[model samples]
Target: MKPSDPEFQEFAEAANLPLLRTARLLTGDWHLGQDLLQVTLTKVYLRWSQADRWDSPTGYARTVMVNTYCTWHRRRWRHELPRERLPDRAGERDTADTVATTDALARALADLPRRQRAAVVLRYYDDLSVEQAARALQCPPGTVMSLTFRALARLRQSADLHDTAVEGR
Candidate 1:
């Protein structure tokens, strides 16, 4: 709450890695994800005083990231292409199967509409309940359920997921 609060700094430090990962998942590009994380963190910092009242401020920051990403998606230049993989090379020990499976999942996730992707990420990746995700999305819980259902259905129908075994949730 206070500008001098060290607790917010600790929260930010603890939340950064997960927030970065979530942003990457949301944007499907590392650079865009980093931008999203920066925007979200700036907003979170501005609201630092009120964040202490929330059940989990980290979760609030995630919600901000989702909102910011959605905004970016809506206004992004049409020419901006999402990358299927990060530029970083894997270590020599990494297997092809692992890389392929990861790419497939990323492609499937990337294909989703912004809202559906947000719902899927919030529900599955972030492990939020439908109600919690609904709050994050500024929608009713039923809408969150419907979005998640459709997102999962689409993911299941994706060529990669269907081509792979991908069983058991």
Candidate 2:
């Protein structure tokens, strides 16, 4: 089938939800996720004529999304306001403990280096194997494994510190 044929539409329809989910997890924000996906899809559509020759169209789009996301903050700042503490406890539907833990995890994720964050999201959250992530990242499988390992270790340390701080309160 031609790359721009109906198959592309079908594939896009099937991929949308999973791609959006991955984007949201990668970005830690829904709005940014949508923007990321939009950019990815636009790029893919522009290259649709080559889709017939791609080893994996889905993989190409995923790699494009990640590369685009990584570059976004480089050219300009998104103007996120950084604060040491929230002025008020928002998103309070959950128990205080759950909310605290979730908040700490989000902060820890934001603090991770971009490559490490990508490794963690692709490996754990997106459930990609080391080999698959390596392909997406254009790196050796060993590198992907190392990146994920370090990311996980850092996350564990962050969690431990958060736990200790809570206990002291």
Candidate 3:
């Protein structure tokens, strides 16, 4: 089916939620995820007719999402504000621990270099093959592997530090 066809729209709509979830996992903010998704959808729309011919539509969307995210990171400086300072909803009090853990993970993710973060997100979160992620990132597969290894190491170190702090407290 052509990208402009109704079936294409249906497929895009059906994939939206999962795409947003993956975006949020990669970006660590709902607003950023929405923005990323919007950008991705716009790119998909522009290339819709061609996208339908690809072997994997979801992979195409993911590559768009990653490219858009990388562009945003490169062109903009996203200010890092402490999560604790943000206003909380009454309902969220019940899920405070979950929120805290997510916040910790997000902070750790933010600490990584952009390419490393992208490698980690694409390889692990999106479950893309190294070759696929390399294509998406316009890098060699060896580079993707290196970035993934470094990112995982950094995340592990940060997690261990967080655990130690909690235990000390």
Best by TM-score: 1
* Pairs in clash, predicted candidate 2: none
Q: Candidate 2: minimum summed lDDT over ten consecutive residues — where?
A: 74-83
Better of 1 and 2 by lDDT: 1
Better TM-score candidate (1, 3): 1
The TM-score of candidate 3 is: 0.78
- Stretches off by above 4 angstroms in model 2 are 74-100, 159-161, 164-169
lDDT of 3: 0.80
Pull out the clashing pairs in model 1: none
lDDT of 2 by residue, 109-146 (tens): 77788788888888988899888899888889999999
Q: What digit string (tens of lDDT, one per residue) describes model 1 on residues 1-169?
A: 3444587788888999999988888887777788899999999988888875777897789888888887774443337667788768867695767667777888899899999999998999889899989888889999999999999999989998666544413
> What is the lDDT, from 0 to 100, of the residue 107 in candidate 1?
84
Q: In candidate 3, how many Å is residue 8 off?
A: 2.5
- Which RMSD does model 3 reach against the true structure? 4.2
